[model samples]
Target: MPDPGSPLARLGVSIQHLLPQRALTALAHRISTARAGWIRRPLIAGFRRLYEVDLDEAVVPASGFDSFDSFFTRALKPDARPPASVGTGLLCPCDGTLSQAGPIFEEPSGGRIVQAKGRDYSLAELLADEKAAEAFTGGRFATVYLAPYDYHRVHVPCDATLRTEIRVPGRLFSVSDATSRHIDRLFARNERMVALFDTAHGPMAVVMVAAMLVAGIETVWDAGLRLRPGRDVARIDFDPTVRLSAGAELGRFHWGSTVIVVTGRDAPDWVDGLVPGRRMRLGEALTGPRAPGRAEN
Candidate 1:
C-alpha cells in the first residue's frame, strides 16, 4: 500500500496540489470551453510521452486526435478488450490503473465510508441520497484512477440495468494519487456523477468522480450534462423502467478522474492477487464466482 503519510507521500501530495483553488477552477472552466483545444494538442503530446501510453489499441489512432482530452478519453478497438463471459464476475468498467480495492469500513456515526487513510466521507455525501446509501452498507468498493493518458470512456462492470442516476455536485479537487493521499475527503469532495444499477450482484454504484481540470462528466444517456456548471449539488432521478447491461457504455469522463464502484455486502471477493497499481482491462473477471447457490443480486 502507498504510505500516504510518508515524507515522499507528503511531497507528492504537495506537488499534485500546488495549484490554487481558484486557479484550478478557472482551469476547469477554460478546459470546458472550445478555445482550450489549442493547448490540448501539446498537452496531449506531453502526456503521451510522460505516461508512455500505448496507442496500438486505441480506437481512433492517437494521430487522429486533435486535443489532449480527446486523446485522453480515446476509444479502444472493439476487440482490444473483450467483456468477461456472462456469469463470470464483476467487470472493469473503464481503462485505468487500479488504485485500491477492498470493503468500505463503515463509521460508527453518520454512516460514513473512509475514502482514504485519514479522510472519512459519508455514503450519503458520496451518493447524495439517503435511500441510495441504504443499498450498499458494508459493501465492496474498487477505486480506479485514470492517469492523463488512460482511456476516459466508462463501461459497465456487469450486465446491469440502470435504476437511477444522480449527479452530486461538490468541489472539484484533484483526484490523482497525490491528491487522494493529501486532500482530506478527496473523492467525496469532488463533483461526481453516480449511476445506480440493479445487477445480478444486487445494487451497484458506478461513481464518476470529478477532479480539478476535469471539464465535465458526460453520459451516454444524456447530453444536457454539457450545459451544467457551478458548485451546487445536483441530482437526477430516473424512472424504474430504464435498464443498462454490463459492458455497456455508462458514460465518459471529459477528462480523466477516479471511478468508484460499490457493491452490496453479498458481492463476492475479488479474483486472487488483483491489487493496487495493477492494470485491468474491461470485461475481465474482477472477482471470483459466488459460493454455490448464492445468486447475483
Candidate 2:
C-alpha cells in the first residue's frame, strides 16, 4: 500500500476528481461496443497484445468476439476455473489481486471495513443500508481488485439464495492502488451494485464497485443496469429467490473494478495466508471445509 500522505498519490487523485468520469466512460462504452470490424478488431488485437490476455483460458477466441467489450468480458473454458470440493470453505468470487482481507470492525457509531493499509470505510455507507451492514459485525471481508487484463465476472462464493440487490449511484473514480490509498473511502464512494445472498452459514454481501471507464455492471439475472446519477438507492427484494451455487456467475464488470465480499459472524474461518497483492482466481477456496457442529441457517 502506498502512503496515504504521499504528495504524488494525492495529486493523482485530485486530478481524477476534476475529470468528467461519466462522459469518458460513456465514450468508452460506445467505442468498445462497436460491431464494425475495422473499429473493433484492431482495438481487440491491440488490447490482447498489450495486456497479454490469456486467449487459451477464454472460451471464445480473440477473433470470435463481435466487439471489444465482449472480448473483455469473455467467459473462460470450463476447466479454467473449477470449484473447490463442497466442504472446502467458500470459493473466491473473481480473478484479481487480494487487495485487503480482514475483519469488519464493530465501531461505536457504525461498522467499519478495511479499505487499504491505513484507511477504513463505513459499512453502512458501503452497503447503503445500515440494517444490512449490521449483519456483518465482527465478520470478515475480502477485497479483490480486477485489472483491465483480469477476468471481469464475479461468482457466488457458496451455495446461496439471492436476497437483495442494490445499486448505489456515486462518482466513477479510478480504483487503482494509488486512488485506494489516497482517496478516503474509495470503494464506498464509487458507484456500486450490492448483492446480498443467504448462504447456509449466514448472510454474505458482495459489493461490486465501478471505476473510471467501467461503462456498466450487469448480473446473470439482470442484463442491463441503467441508473440515473443520484444519492437515492435503487433496490430489489426477491420474494421468489434466486439460488446460486458456488462458482456460478453472479455479475460482471464492463471493465476493471473492485469487489468487496463480506461474510456474517456464523461463516467459517477465512483460510490462512490472505496477504495483500495475492493473486487469486475464481472458484479457489478461501477457507477450509465447514467445521463439525456448524449448522445451516
CA lDDT of every candidate: 0.74, 0.87
Q: Write the per-residue lDDT of candidate 1 for residues 174-277, one digit (tens) a residue.
A: 77666676787778877888888887778889989887777778888886355233566666567654677768787887777889888888776776555778
Global Cα RMSD, each model? 4.0, 3.6
Model 1 bad stretches (over 4 Å): 1-19, 22-25, 28-41, 86-88, 110-114, 227-230, 290-297
Cα lDDT, model 1, residue 3:
69
Across 1-297, the per-residue lDDT of candidate 2 in tens digits comes to: 455458877888899989999999999999999999999999998998898988999998877999999998899999999787748368899999999987788879888988877799999999999999988887889999999999998999988999999989999999988888878999999999999989988999998999899988889878664523346788999999999878889988888899999998988877767889899989888876445675522
lDDT of model 1 at position 14: 72
Q: Against the hidden reference, what TM-scores do the models get?
A: 0.83, 0.93
Candidate 2 lDDT trough over 10 residues, lowest sum: 288-297
